[model samples]
Target: MHLFSALAVISVTVLQAAAHGYVPLLRINGKDVPGWDISKDPYTTPQPLRVVRGTKLDSGFISDVTSPDITCSIGNQKLPPGPIQATVAAGGTVQVLWNTWPLGHFGPVLNYLAKCPSSDCSTFKGDTGAPWFKFQQDVFSNGVWASDTLARNNYTYNVRIPSNIAPGSYLLRHENLALHAASSQGGAQFYPGTFILTPVSPTTPFTELSLVCIQLTVTGGGSLNPSGLSFPGVYKATDPGILFNVYRGDAANQVIL
Candidate 1:
């Protein structure tokens, strides 16, 4: 009887695996490290996007929502946390896709949190600061928690890669101010992890070999800028190991642009 049960379980597991067909998944919890990249195309004046070598990219979101649909909402979300590794030649327009998640889960507190530290509510931090004052305002200043995120499954935004971005590698950070929370008590409160983006590239399409990996990190720290705080500056990787250092341009004749 026990053997039969075990066989039955194995059969079910195989069936489930077959049904899913080994779908590709991206994690949001800072584990399961992953990456991707882009390359240059020579056919047109404006280059076509190509996957560069040795590049890793990461994506993330701010809310605590764990529903299947909620998790799906984060898939391919744009800007900081989403994929942004496409190549454009000199003086070309680069179109990008950015996804936004629903906002209802955050409730009425959204307005207040959006403009936090405005001499109104208190703030705090997540992994560092105290509880009561863990959150601040400037954190979400870069983003407008518009209404659409609260309504649908997918929110898309179109953007152009600036021509002036140069040819060097860059990192994009998407911060979703999920909520406010304190550490212990009367300590501090800050937002939660939302989204992140990393850029990597190797050699150009014409070059021999190039590798690039994009790294993205999302944190709860806002613009509370203290006198002695150690911020590597916003959009910068706090640690060198997590840094996305995908070099651009040709291999032998590469320019740090």
Candidate 2:
């Protein structure tokens, strides 16, 4: 017989009972689950699966369950020693790399965002169209993560930090990273990290600049107010989202602190 499981939109946390060969049907805000299938058997123990929650579906988020052995890192970069600097000049690319151990079978779900920490992001509210910068995924090679088939073997992300992204200390929030193979079990996890985009004087290309560490916060005035910035920043279901490697000159940079 085919078994089915469903969760309602009550103010309670959704939990699954321990069982074998059980399938899950995801329902969002009373509407049909756009890209989900119960018979497809997407649920997996010890694997990471992307799940959305909230009453009005206004709260968009990525929930991740930690894997037994999971890890992450940011590609090398040269950030300035200070907190603020000029934005990365126009026409520049940064390389961000991710290394997941024990490589699984399922690919990771990736998300990226850039926000300033201090004072609510209300200044440039509704300026979602700002050409702040651009980040692109480079590659997801399968060598570095061979030990863990679930891990991202090898990958590269190339992003160009646009020159118009007003000069300020920004937080590049990248999350929702799931490994393959672990998709059906219980290893869908959030690979969240922050990158500092310091806009410095474009006098000369500063290579190997030191990066300063800072906390990330986006209160958005109150609970009802949404952080006024393009969210989840950049998203990718299979490959890395944003690359943070800095080559030279003025450009956005990222580091794990």
Candidate 3:
């Protein structure tokens, strides 16, 4: 009886460990930023490693894409703006450090930026109406995406701020999608993200800017809907990007958009 109890405990412990991991630290231009305490509050308590099962759908994966939790997993309420965390030039790089990501979770990494109307985002309240632009995305390349690459190497993700982005105080959002179990609908695990305030210097160029959009449509279907895609609005349980098989070794089967 004792041996059986020990085995059960081991299984529970392993399951718990697999369900939790988060980005505890953030850096810009190689310098650590402040305000991680505020950013991590929505996901877990007591500062670090605050991992919850999150909102799950029928298939036991995170599927509440329309919830406010989809945006930083923090409820969409006005948060008292805190101190400015870090400042960098428009073309600088931001690095995100995760506590620990399980090797079994393999998928892509994406980053988005939303400019605040105020000069200092530290004073801006939580408003979900801000327009966000995709600044960086890592798709499957050479048999690996950002998550796969991070699993083999370091726990840090580096993102370069667009040189043409307008100088302003902005909120940066980083996301990681673990599709290891996404073969069925609603099985994709999503680590939405936390927000960080970053002020961009005006020295960089902004006039010469161009926008490009790639629309992918399945063989028999019409163009994929690209309009009205907010963080909480863009993803749905039935979207091809959310329901895919990544273990098949075929890059086409795994959509990273």
TM-score (all chains, Cα) for each model: 0.25, 0.28, 0.63
- TM-score for candidate 3: 0.63
lDDT assessment of candidate 1: 0.20
Which segments of model 3 are wrong by more than 4 Å? 1-19, 34-63, 76-81, 122-130, 186-229, 252-257
Q: Report how far residue 203 has shifted in candidate 3, in Å.
A: 54
The 10 consecutive residues of candidate 1 with the worst lDDT sum are 2-11
Model 3 lDDT, full chain set: 0.44
lDDT of 3 by residue, 150-242 (tens): 666677777676665565566665666655555554222332222111112333211100010111111122222111225555556555555
Residues 109-188, model 1: lDDT tens digits: 11001111222111111112211111211111123222233223233221222332234322222123222110012211
* Ordering by TM-score: 3, 2, 1
User: Best-fitting candidate, measured by TM-score?
Assistant: 3
TM-score result, candidate 1: 0.25
In Å, residue 60's CA in model 2 sits off its true spot by 24
Each model's lDDT comes to 0.20, 0.22, 0.44
Best by lDDT: 3
